[model samples]
Target: MADLRDVAMDSKAWPFQEARALAKRYEKAPPEKGHVLFETGYGPSGLPHIGTFGEVLRTTMIRRAFELISDIPTRLICFSDDLDGMRKVPDNVPDQAMLRENLQRPLTSVPDPFGEFESFGHHNNAMLRRFLDTFGFEYEFISATEFYASGRFDETLREAARKYDDVMKIMLASLREERQQTYSCFLPIHPETGRVLYVPMKEVNAEDGTITFDDEDGREWTLPVTGGHVKLQWKPDFGARWAALGVDFEMYGKDHSTNTPIYDGICEVLGGRAPHHFTYELFLDETGQKISKSKGNGLTIDEWLTYASTESLSYFMYQKPKTAKRLHFDVIPKAVDEYHQQIRGFKGQEPVQQLANPAWHIHGGQVPESDLVVPFSMLLNLASVAGAEDKATLWGFIRRYAPDATPKSHPGLDAAVGHAVRYYNDRVKPHKTYRMPDVSERAAMEEVLAALDEWQGEADAEALQNMLYAIGKEHRFDPLRHWFQALYEVLLGASEGPRFGGFIALYGIEETKALIVKALRGDLAHEEPIDI
Candidate 1:
C-alpha cells in the first residue's frame, strides 16, 4: 500500500491533516511514490493487552487510508522492545524479576524465563504479532536485540546523536520529570547478563569491517556481529533510533504520553522538527478492569481472533481515537456483519482520505486494492453458494462471489467457504431451531411449518422475515430470535443456523421442514452445523 506523502495536496482532514503538517515540518516532504512510515508497538512480555492492537491498528488504518488516496508506499515497523528486563510479576510469570537489580535496562527487557515462548521477550513479542497478524497487518518487525547487534543503525545512532547534540540534549532534558535515570545519558546494559554492552572502541579506528562488543560479565562475551542485537539507551537512543530509521508515524497509549511529557517534544527533536502525528487516549475493558499484562488481566490479539475477523478489528480501530471503549468479544461477529453491510452501502469501500499537509505527506492514503477487502462481495457470494444446495452449486457461487476470500482449487476452500457462510448467516439472518418436546411450541412450530409446507415456490426474502416474525409474535416468543434458535436446533440439529427465511429460500422450504421434523425426531444429531 502507498504511504502518506503521495496525497499531501489532496486534502486536509483530521488524520491526514495532522499527518501532513508533521511531515512538512520535519522536512520530510511527502512523495509521489511516498516514503515508508514506521509504526511501532511492543509485545506484552507476559500477556498482551488490547493496547498493542489499539496502538498499531490505528496507525495501520491511517497508512491504509493514505495509500487509498495516493500512489505512495506505506510500511509499518513494529519494535518489540522485548530486551528490557522484566519489571513486574504476572500470573503467568511466577518467577518475575522483582529486584531493581534484576530489572535490566530498557534496551534489554523481557518476562519470566519459564514462559511460553523460547525467550520471555520472544513470548511477549509473539503475542503482539498474533494480534496484528490476526488483522493481517503488515509491518517490518524488529527486535531490540537484532537492532543493536546487527549494527545496521549503530553508526547512524552515533552520527544522529553526535550531529544533533544540542537538540538531543533538549529532548532528553524535556523528559527529566518522568525520566527514571538521573544520569541524563546512560550506557546500554545487557538484559540477560546485566552489564554494560559495548563494542571495542579500540577497534573502531580501523576502516576495515572490524568490531568487538562484550561485557566482563561471564555470558556477556562478544559474538561475531552475526548481528543479533542493538545496543542503545532509552533516552536519546530512542530518539536517535527514530531519526536514523525515518519513522514517520507511530502512536503510544495515553498513559505513556501522560506520564512522558517529553515524547512529542523529543520526537520533534529527533526528526529535526516534529513527528508526522500522535493520537492518544486511555484504555477500555470488555467487562471490567483496564487490561494489564503485569496483572495477567489483559486479553491478547490472538484472543480476539478466536471470535472476530481482521476487518472487524480494523473497523474497531477506525472509531474515534481520543475516546476509550471496551471491545467486548461478543459484539465482534455482529460488528463484522455490520461492517460488511456498510461496504455494500458504499457500493464497495470507503474512498481513501489524502494527506492535506504537503510537508509530511510521506505516503499516500489508500490501501492497495489488493489489501483492501470488499466485505459485501464476500457475503453476497457466500449466500448464493450456500443457497444453491449442492456442493457444485455452492462451489460455483463461492468461486464467483469471493474469489479472493478463498481459493476454489485449494483443499481448504470448502472449510474457508463454510466459515464465510457461517459468518453471513450469523450476521444477517440468525435463526435457531429447537426440538418440540411439549406440543405448544410443537403445534405452533408445526403450524408455521405447515404454512410453509403447504405453499412456497419462490423464496421471498422480506416476506419470510415478516412471516417468521409474525409466527414468533403470535406464539408469544421473544421476537423471531428465540423461535429461530429452536427451529435451528430442530432443523439443523444445532443451537442455530442462518435466518429461516434465507435458509428456506436457499435450500427450499420443504427441505427445511423435513430437516426440522427429522431433527425433532432424533434422526439428525449426526449432522454438523453447515450453511443451509
Candidate 2:
C-alpha cells in the first residue's frame, strides 16, 4: 500500500482533489468553529431510493478524501426534512386515503400508513437510517421535526423572521408574479387546524420574533418564531441549516443550481456563509426522464442490491458524479463487471495510479487482494445456460476452470454467483434471442470449435483472444468484429457477451466446444437478428 500523504498531495482523482482543495480553502479561513461539517439532505416523503443511496455514497467518498488530506475534525449530517408538508400521497405506500386526508399537514403530523412508526415521517426517516446503516455510513441523522421541536434552530428561525423582507425579496425574484402574492419566507403552522400554511403573512415583527397570518378559517393568528410554530420555506430552510450547523460542504443536484444563489444570499442575510457547493447531474431512468421517487420510475435500492453487490453500486456512483447517467437494471451487469476489473487490477498498479482508481475510494483506500477468476456477467451467462439455481451449480463450472478455487475461500465470487442467478432469472431469460449462423458465420464457428481442442484448457484470455481473432481472420468475416458476435449469438443467444476467451476459460473448453457444436447442429438456432 502507498502512503496516503503522497496520494493526497498529487492524486488527480476528482473527488480526492476536490476534497483537498476544499480543505485548503477552509483551513485558510476556518468557519465560526474549528470543525468542518458536511451535510446531505433527504426528503423522507417516500422510502429511501437509489438516488438517496447515490447522494450519501458520493458524499462519503468526498468525506473519505477530505480525511486523507486534513486532520481537522469533521462530521457529516444526514438531515431528513421531515417537517415538510405532505403535498401528495406516495402511490407505493398503503392506506392512501389516510395520507390524502393529511395533505397540507406536516409530515410528522401525518399518520404512518405502514403502522410501524408513530408518524409517516418517522417511518420514512427510520427507513433512511436503516439504508445508510446497511452501507456502514458514518453520519449523524438529523430530523427537521426534531431540530425544530428541540429549539436547536431557534436562533436561525428568529434571524429569518427579522430578515423576512430581505429573504422574501430574494426568493420572490425567482417566482412568477402570481406566486409572489402568496409567497412568504416563513410557513407558520396554523394553531387551530394544525396544518402548515403557505399564505401571505399580514405582519412580521422583527423585534418580537412573531408573524401574523390568516388561517384557512379566515381567522387572524400570530405565531411564535421558535418552538416548532413555524418552518422556513425550503430555500430559506437550506440557508438556515447551513448557518445553524456551520456546514462546510454539501452537494446538490443540478436541477437546484438555478436556486443555489438564492440559498447563498439567504444564508449571508442570516449572518452565515453557505457551505462549499458541488452540483452533480441528476440520475435519469431508461426513458431519460429524471428519476422520481413519487413516480417510481427508476430502479430502487433494493432492486439494485438484489442484482449486484453494494460495492458495485458504490463504483457506479464513483464514476464522474458531475455527469448525467441513466440508471436502470441494464446498468447493473456492466457496473458489477467494472468493479471486478478494478479490484483485479488494484494490486499491480503504481501507488499514485492506484489512488486514482475507483476501487481505492470504493474500498476506503484499502484494496483487497484477490485473483481474477470469472466476471459477474460471465457468471450470469453461465447460470442462465446451466439453469443454475444455487451456488453449487455455478461453482461446479468454476472448479472445472480453476481446480483449486473453493466457495469458502472465494466469498466474493460465491456471492456474485447468487446475484447472477437472480439477475438472469429476472432480467435476461425473457429477452433472450439466438440467431442461426449465416453461411460465412458457420465457417467461422467450425474453425473456432476445432481450435478449442488445441487450447489444452491452459491458455490465458489474451492468448485465447489472439487465437480467436486469427480464426476470424482466417475465415474472412467482414469487419472482423462479427466473429465474436457470431460466437455470442450461437452460444449465449445474445449479440454481445463477455470476452470469448474469458468465457471459454471459465465455462471450460470442452463444454464450450460442445455448446458450439450444438449451435452448429442448429440446436440453438432461432430467428434472424431483429432489425432494430
Candidate 3:
C-alpha cells in the first residue's frame, strides 16, 4: 500500500481543488463535523453496479470524517434522479423493450419490465442500498419523485430563476446559437375531458420573479415560459433541485463531469445554491466495446461485493475519479485485502511498514489502503497453487484441512476466497484445460511424485517445499519448480495452478495424493461447473 504521504506527493489535487473552489464560490467556510449538511447524489441506473457505491460510500466516508473533526452535524442523503428520462437501458436490466417504448416519458414512470419489484429505477436503487448497508454505511436515500413532490425543490427553482435569469438567458442564447438547445412554451389546451391540459398558476409574476404554478387542472403542471416554455428542463431541473436541497457535496462520474457545469449554472439561476464540493469518478469497463454481464462485468455492485469489501469499494471512490482507470474484476480482491491491511496499520492493529506509503485515518476507520495491492499475502496463495486443483477444489481442500476452527479465520479470508474463486473461474476449464502432463510425461511426473512421497509427514511448509524442488531437479525439471508441475499434472491434470506448497499443507497429504491420482487416470471430464 502507498503511504498517505507518498500518495499525496504523487497525487493530483485537481479534484480537491475543484471541491474547495466550489465551496469558496459559494462563500461557505470549510465544513465542520456535526454541523455541516452533506448531500450526495446518484443516478438510478437500476441494479447499481459497483461504481454506484464507489460514488456514495466515499462521500459518506468523507462526511463522517468531517463530522468527527468538529461539532458540525452531518447527514448522508443519496438523491436518486429517477425523474430523468431513460438514456439507455443497461444491458443487465430486463425490459430492453421499455428503453425504446419509454422514449419521452420520465424514467420513474417506466414500469419495471422484469417482475422483480417496483419501477426499474427503484430496483436498482435497492441493490445499491444493499451493497452500502453491507459495508455499514448509513445513508438516507431520497428519490427524485418524492423530493420534487414534497416541495423541497420549489424554492430553489423559483429563486434560482429569479436570481440568475440574466446569466442563464445569455448562456441559453449562446447554446441555441451553437445549435445545441431547444426551448418550448406550455399552451394549456383542454384535453378530451374539457379540463385544461395544464392548470395555470394560481398567481404568477414573470416580470417580478414571482411565478406560481399550482394544480388547477386536477393534475400537477409545471409553469410555462417566455417566447418559449421555461419550466426547468430535464438536466437543469436537477441543478435547481440540488440548489434547493442545499447539497453541500456531491460526486459524479467522468461521463457526467463534462456537462455538470451546465447543472451548476442552472442551479445558480434558480436561486438554490449548487453543491460546493464534488468528486468526478472515472469509468468502469467503458473501454471495452463489449462488457461482460454474465461474469458480473460492467456496473454490477453485487459482482464487486463478491470480490471486494465495502471499504475497499469505498477506497476505489476516494482515488481521483478519472476517466482513465479500469477497475477490472481481476484486480479487485487484492485491492480489498490491501484495504484490510491499511485498516490494520492505520489503527495500530498491525506493525508499521518498513517503508513509507500513503494511508490515513478518519472517523476511526483508516482510509482504505493504496490502490496497488503490491505482493500481498492472500494473493501469494493463488500465485502459489501448482496446478493441484481448480480454485474451487483448492478452496474446498483448504476448508476441509485447515478449517476456520478458531474463533476467527485468517485476516484475509474473504479476499482469499474471492481470489481463489476468480482464479478458478478464469483459468480452470473443464475441457481443453492446461493439464499437468500425460503418461507420456510420466518420467518427469514420477520424479516429482517421488519427492512428494519422501516429503510425507514433513509438516513444515518450507521444508516440504525444498524437498519437492530437490526431487524435480533430479528429473530434469527446474528444481525450483520441480514438484509444482508434477503435482498439477497428477492432481489437476493441469501444468499450473494456485500455490502448491500451501495446498499440500492446507489440504493434507492424503487429499493431495487422491487428487493427483484422479488427474493421472483422466477420470475427471469436462463440464462447466457451478460456483460452490
Candidate 4:
C-alpha cells in the first residue's frame, strides 16, 4: 500500500495538482510569514451568490489538499471589499431610493436597506458570513473597512503611494485613451460628502503619503493615503491587497483572468510576491448568460439548498472547476444523485483512487458511507407518479423498498425524499406535458399491463426490467429507449424518468399496475395535455 501523502503528491486530481504547485512555492523553505495563506475575495456591491460561495469552496479544497501533501500550517481568509463605493443599487434589494441616495459613497457608509446591520456593506458581509457559516467553513473574515481604519494596511498603502507612478504605468496601459486621461491609482473620499472621487490626482506626495484631488464641486483637498482616507482603484487594490496580506494562493473566475498581469505587477511593485492564481471558468444560466449577483438571474445558494443537500452543491463545485457549468434548478437532481453515487463508490476504491474521488475532497478525506439506496432522480419519478406531497408520503414507498432502513438510520435518503417532494412540487409539476401514446407506444404499454398481470413472486427490479425489455423487444421498440420514453411520457408525464423496473419495485407491483391502468385509460393528470 502506498502512503497517502505520496499518493496525494502524485494524484492527478485538480485540487492536488493545484496544491502541488502551491507546495512547490515553498519547497526549499516554508513561507516566512510562518504559514501559507489562501484568500478568496468578495465584492459586497450586492448579495453574495453561488459563484461567490464557489470561490471559497474551491480555495478550501486546494487548502485541504495542501495540508495532505505538506506539514506546513495553512490559513484561509474570506476578504470582503466593503470599502468599495456603491456604483449602482442592486435591483434585487429593497429601498432603492435609499441606495440611490447613497450611490458613490463607500458601501460601509451607505444605509442598510434591509435595516439588519450597521450599513449596506455590513448587511451583505453578514450575509456572506452567514452563508460560509452555514457550511461550517473554517475561515478568517476580514473587512477592508476595518483593515484600513485599524492601520493594518498603513504600510502597504504608504508603499503604494511611494510607487504611485509605477502603479499608474501598469494601470494606464490597460485603459482606453479616454479612460486613461482621468484614471488614477488612488480614489479619494470627499471629506464633506464621504463619496469616493474618481477624479485625476493633482499631486501625489509620497513623502507625506497624501494625494491632492479636486472634488466634483472643484474644491481641492489632500488626504493621507493611510487611515482609510483614500483607497486604490479596483485593479490596483487587487494586487495591493495581496501584498498587504502576503496571500500565497487565491482563485477567481475567468472574468478576472485578463487582469492577472496587472494584479501581479502591482503586487510586485509594492514589494510583495504575487500569489499563485487559479482561474476557473464562470457559471452560466439556463439561457447561457453569465450568472450575476446583481441581476439575480441564476439559481441562488438558498434556492439550491431548498431542493438539494449542501454536500451535493459542494460536489457540483468540486467537479471540473476549469469548465463552465450551467447552474440551474434542472441541474440539482443530477448533482444530488451523482454525489451519492460517488460516496457509494468510495469504499471500494483503492487508496489512490479514493484520493482521486470527489467525495474524499468534498468531505476533507473523511467521506461518509452513503445510505441512499434509492437515487434522488428515482425518488422524483416516484414523487411525480404518486403525487407525493410530503416526505411521509414518499417514506411509505421507501420503507417498502428498503425494509430495514429508517429515517434515523438512513437520514440522507430521508432528506433526499423531502428534497424530491419539494422538487416535484416546484420544478417537475409545473411544466409536465403528457401525451396520448401513439399506436405503437399504446400497444407496448398494453403488453406491459398484461405482463404485470402475469408477474408473480417478489417484485425484483432486475427481473421486472428484463420482462419490460422482452416486451419492448416483442413490440419492436428498436432502440429500447423508445419503450422507456413511452412509459415515462404516458405514465410519469415527463419526457424522461427513472428506470421503470426500479420505480415499480419501490412503488409496489399492485400500485404500478394501477398506474398503468390509469395511463392506459388516459386518466393520468398533467399540467397540460398534448397529443403525439
Candidate 5:
C-alpha cells in the first residue's frame, strides 16, 4: 500500500494529478469540517443528461484517487439547484401547455408533467439519483429548495445580503451594460403568485437580512433572504454554494469556464475560500453541435446503457476529459472493446502502469479480469454476416471457437454478445451496403476460397492471416489493407471489420468459404452501384 501511494503521488494520470493538488491544500492542517467535501452541481430544470453523468463520474474518480494518497476522509455531494426558476419549457417532456404556464416559477413549484413526483424538480432529481444509483455512486443528494427552505443556507444568504454591493461589483463587470442596470444578486420569489421575480432590488437591507423589490404587477414587497423567500441569482449562487458547502473541489463544463472568477470572487467576499475547479470540454453530437439538455439532441444515459455496459460508458468518461468528444452510437463499440482490452491487459502491466490504467480508476482499484475473449467489433461483424437476431445464434459459433466457454462462465462476454446483436440490428443493419467484387477483387476472392478448401488442419488465425497477407501480395494490391477492405465490403456489407483471419476462425472455415462463394456469385451484392 505504501509503494502504491508513492507511485500515485507521482502518477501522470489526470485524476491523480487533480487529487494531488487537492491533497496539497491541506498539507499544513486538516479542514475544519474534518473531511474534504467534493461537489458536483446539477440544474434540475431539465432531466439529467449525459453531462451530469460525466461530471459526477469524473469527480468520483478524483475522490477515489485522493483516498489513496491522503489520510483525510472525503464526502461527495450531488447538489441539485432545484430552486432555480424554469425560464423556458423543455421540448422533450410531455404536456407542453402545462409547463408553459409554470415559467419563471421555481422548478420545485412547477407540476411534474410525468405525474410521478411532487414537482418537475423532484422528478428530475429522482431521475438523477436513480441514474447515479445504477452505477453505485456514493453521494449525498442535496436539493437547493430543501436547503433554502430548511434554513441550511441561512448564514450564507445573510452573508450575501451583507456583502451585496461587493457581490454586485464582481457580477456587474461581467454583464452587458443593459443587464448591469437591473441585475441584483438576489431574486425574490413573489409571496402571492409563487413566481420568482426578476425585478431590480430597490433596497438591500443587510442588517435585516431582507431585500425590497417590486413585482411586475407594481406592488412593493420586502422579503427576507432566509427561509426560501429569496434565492441568489445563478452566477451568485454558483459561488455562494461553494462558500456555503466549503467544497474542497468541484468540476464543471467548459461553458462555465468564463464564470470561474465571478464565482471565486463572490465566495471570497462571503468569507469562504474558493474551491479548486476543473472545467472539462463539453460533449458534442454527431454533427459537432454542443449537446443540450433541453433540446435532447445527443445520446441519453438510458440509450447508451441499452447498447453497452456501464463500465464502457465510464471508460468513455475517463478518456482525455479536456478534449471535446462526439458522444454517439459509433463510439460505443470502441469504448466497450477498449474497456475490456484494458481489463485484459491489467494483469500483465507493471504496478505503476496499472495505477495509470483507466480500468483501475473506473473500478475503484479492484479491476475485474475480463472474460470477454471476443472483441465487441468482431461480434458486431459476426452478427452482421449471420443476420443474428438473438444471442443464441452468436453463441452457436462462440461455442465452436471456444469449446469450454458458456454464458455462465463468461458473463461479460455473454452480455457483450447480447449488446452486439442489438447494436448490429439497430445501428448496423439499416445502413449496410454490399457491392459486387470488381474483376481483380473477384479473382482474389476465388483464390481465398480455393485456399480455404485446400486447408487440412484446424483453423489457426495467425496462419490464416499470413496466408491472406500472401494472397494480397500475390494480387499486387498497392496497400495490403485494400485486400482486407475488399473482403469486408464484399462479404460483410460494411467498410470496416475485425481481422479477416480471426473472423474466419470464429465463424468457421466452411462458413467463410460459403460467404465468399456467395459474394463472387453476386448473391450478397446489392443491385445498386458501389459508392466506394
Candidate 6:
C-alpha cells in the first residue's frame, strides 16, 4: 500500500489530491468492514440522460483516483432510486394515458409504457444500464426497488424509524408553512391500493420500528420498518442511503447543495457520518436555461454519441465540473477538438506532468499515444468545402496532404470525417451563407493562388501560415485581424474557421488554387460581402 501522504505529495492531479484527502479521512476513521464505497445516484423517472452520465462518469473518475493511492478495497455503487413514486408521466415517453393512470404509484409497480420491461422503473433502469454499459463503465448497479424489497435497507430503515421524530423536525424545518401541515418523513405504501401515500403517520411505535398511517380511503394500517411497506421522503432517503451503504463520497448537482446540510444532519441523527459531498453546477441549454429531464429540452447521451466519440463526451465532463457549462450540438466540435488536443499534449509530457494532464483522468490514466491527423473542426470545414460525404472522398484529401497517412492507420480521423460530413449536411449546410470577397480581397486571394501554384517543394502548415500572414500584411489587410476571414469568406463562406494554413495544406495546394480561381471567377460568390 502506498503511503497516502507520499502519494498526495507526489502528484498534481486534482482527482489524486481529492483521493489523498479522502484516504486521510478514512484512515482517521475507517468505514465498517474496511471498505471504501463511492456512490452515484439516479432517478429512474425517465430514461438516463447526459446529466445522469455526467454524474456517474465523474464519480467513476474519482473512484479511479482513489484506487491509485490506496490498497483498501473500493466499490462504486450506481444506485437507482427506482422505488420512488411516479408523480407525473414523462413527456418523452409514449402511452401517456397509461402512465397517467399509474401516477402516485411506485415506479416499480407502474406498467412499462414501452411494454418491454415489467414496469416503468424497470424499463428506465434497463435503459440506464445499457447507456452505462455502452461506455464500458466499471461499477455495480443496485436498484432501489430490489435493495429495499430484499431487506438490504432493513437496518437503516429501523434506524430511520427510531429517529422518526428527529427526522421529521429536520424535514419540516425546510418546508414551507403550507407544506408542513401534511408532510411526513415516512410515506406508507397502501396495502390494497399499492400507492405511496403522503399522509402523516397516525401513530408511531419507535420501540418496534413500526408506524400506523391511514390510507387515502381513511383505513388505518400498521406496518413494520423491516418490510418494504414504507419509504423515507427524498431528503431523508438521501441521508438513509448514505448511512445504509457507508458511502465515503458522492457528487450531485448544485440544485441539491442547499439540502446537503440537512441530509448530513439527518445522517448524524441516524447514527451515521456524512459522506464527502461535491456539488457541481447544472448543465444549461444553449439559451442558458437549466436542462430538465421532464422538460426534455437539452442534448441527450444518445444525441451526443451520435455525432461525437465517447472520449470527447468524457473530456467535456472532465472540464471544471463545478462551473456551469452549456451542453448543446454547437459545443460538440470544440469538445472533439479539445479531446484531440489533450491526446496530442499527453504524448510529449513527462511522466509526472502526464499524470496531472486532463487526459490522464479522462482516460483513467491509460492515455493513448496517437497522433491527431486532423482536427474534427477542420474535417467539418473540409467536408463542407469539398462536398465529401464518404470516407473515400475525405481520405482522398488526407492522403494527398499526408502521403504517409491512411484511413486504416487513422481510424479516429476516419470516423470523425464521417460524422463531420453528416453534421455538415444536417446542421451547417442549411444555414450556411458564403460571402463574396470584395475587389481588394479578390486581388489578395489571387496573389495567394499564384504563389501556391508556383511553389514546388513541400509546404507545411507553418510555412503556409507564414506566407498567408505576409500576404495579408503586404496587401494592407491586417494579418492579425482580417487575413483568415478573407480566406474563410472566399472558400468556406464563414467569418471564422479552422486555421487557414492548416486547412489549405490539408486540402492540397492544387485544390486551394482551384477554390481561389472559382472564387475570383465569381462562381462561388455570394450576393454581397458580409461585414465583420
TM, every model: 0.59, 0.95, 0.67, 0.98, 0.98, 0.94
Question: lDDT at 184 for candidate 5?
Answer: 91
User: In model 6, which runs have C-alpha deviations exceeding 4 angstroms?
Assistant: 1-12, 525-532
**lDDT rank order:** 5, 4, 2, 6, 1, 3
What tens-digit string does per-residue lDDT give for candidate 3 at 387-474? Answer: 3233444455445545552213443453545554554454343332425355535665555455556664545556656656655566
> Which residue pairs collide in model 2, if any?
none
Cα lDDT of model 1 by residue, 225-334, tens digit: 22333344455555655665666676776666642435444555545333455757665566666677676554556555544555555556555667776665445545
| Global lDDT of model 1 | 0.52
lDDT of 5 by residue, 357-377 (tens): 999999999999998988899
lDDT of each: 0.52, 0.85, 0.51, 0.91, 0.92, 0.83
What's the ranking of the predictions by TM-score, best on top? 5, 4, 2, 6, 3, 1
* lDDT, candidate 2, 147-258, per-residue tens: 9999999998888888888888899899999999999988999887778898899999999999998887788999898999999888889988998888888899999898
Off by over 4 Å in 2: 1-3, 453-463, 526-532
Worst 10 residues of 6 by lDDT: 523-532
**Backbone clash tally (model 6):** 0
- Per-residue lDDT tens digits for candidate 6, residues 109-180, read 999989999999999899899999988898899988888889999998988877888988888899999999
RMSD of each: 9.1, 3.1, 7.5, 2.2, 2.2, 3.0
Give per-residue lDDT, candidate 6, residue 89: 82
Task: Give per-residue lDDT, candidate 6, residue 464.
Answer: 91
Identify the superior model by TM-score, candidate 4 or candidate 6.
4
